[model samples]
Target: MAVDPRGVDLKRLLAEDSGEPLVMLNLLRFAEGGAESYREYARRLSETFLPRYGGEVLYAGTGSTVLVAEDGQSWDAVIIVRYPDRTAFSRMVADPEYQEVTRLRTAALAEAVLQATTPWS
Candidate 1:
């Protein structure tokens, strides 16, 4: 039920760099009454941090009916983001300004799955 990434997580992400664009899959479970905060975080990210860090939100949406999953496995939202590279992603998370905004995301989520993806050859 971890809602935020730790320093070690970022370090591990960097260590696995492929020198190619990195895509991150985000599965979010919102805390009660926390949707608005997450929206605000997303807005700021799309408007400023993303551009500054060479990142783009590929897709974002609320989860609908679960097509396939365990009873409690349904997510509240999903977002896919692409970064120029793992370094760019790492830098964004380390930015002082971004650090401030990230609190909204952390507070909004009860649980989250933030996983990096590799495209097929």
Candidate 2:
């Protein structure tokens, strides 16, 4: 049921200064008729916000049958997005214009997991 990060979450993210590129792992579950809405959100995000924040989609794909997972653990889609850094990601989310378009994404998902990943060295 956690679709978007909160202000506190962003603050916490910013407090950790890794100073490295971040990859966000997104696990999404759409509500009925929500995939279409999410598609629109994705289009707007890619065109308007991503470049502004130096972000890019590494991968996006619809989920299929889960070969291995706990019960009630399957997702509807998965997306991996790379951002220049945590600050860039934070700024993108806080942008006024991006906030307006985020409504579509909020409406589209029943549940989501947005996790920041650092490459293992």
Candidate 3:
């Protein structure tokens, strides 16, 4: 139900920083008519905010049939985005302009999982 990260969540993310690039794994379940709205959010993110914050979309795709997952665990979409670091991601979310368009993302999702990933050695 929580689409956006909270202040405490941000603090925890920063505290765990390893000074390496972070890849965010986003699992999304769209509400009715949410896909279109999410598309607009993606457009703004790819065109403006991502560049400003040194972030980029590594992959974005609609979810298909789940080969392996518990019942009611399938997602509507999956996206991977890379940020220079946790601080950059935190700053982007804090940006005034980015905040304006965040509603689109929030309104579009019934549920979401935003997880930060570290590369394997």
Candidate 4:
């Protein structure tokens, strides 16, 4: 099952991000046990994507519990990447190299949700 860990309104959360002028952003709750390859994915993300576009990433955290207590932590990581805007984000998603890591990105996620947000305040 997917977990809802949000405690803040992301649109509001990003109100001050004028750096890249994020158009669309994705929130990822990577499944537990991806520790082995997380670094590799990060490397790919940094080298292959961030620079290609104009943006930065704000990683949330790693929770220490699961959906059900005693089940233990299920999320390997939590990430939020802000792109230059909707078009840049879309272009990044359609990039060939990103397509290659789609599987690994899938394998690492128990489930995730992406959102389109703008400043609320």
**lDDT for predicted candidate 4 compared with the true structure:** 0.60
Error of 1 at 30 (Å): 0.5
Model 2 TM-score, 2 decimals: 0.97
lDDT of 3 by residue, 4-103 (tens): 8999999999999999999999999999999999999999999999999999999999999899999989999999999999999999999999999999
Q: Write one digit per residue (lDDT tens) for candidate 1, span 11-62.
A: 9999999999999999999999899999999999999999999999999999
Ranking by lDDT: 3, 1, 2, 4
Model 1 per-residue lDDT at 92 = 96
Runs off by more than 4 Å, candidate 2: none
* Reference-based lDDT, residue 95, model 2: 98
For the record, the alpha-carbon RMSD of candidate 3 to the native fold, in angstroms, is 0.6
Q: Estimate each model's TM-score.
A: 0.98, 0.97, 0.98, 0.62
Prediction 3 TM-score vs. true: 0.98
Of 2 and 3, which scores higher on lDDT? 3
Model 4: CA > 4 A from native: 1-20, 23-27, 64-76
Better of 1 and 2 by lDDT: 1
lDDT, candidate 2, equals: 0.95
Per-residue alpha-carbon lDDT of candidate 4 for residues 16-109, written as tens digits (9 for 90 to 100): 4454466444445556775545556667877878889765776646655565755443544556777776556556666788767655666666
The candidate 3 region of ten consecutive residues with least summed lDDT is 1-10
Best candidate, lDDT-wise? 3
Model 3 has how many clashing residue pairs? 0
Which candidate would rank higher by lDDT, 1 or 3? 3
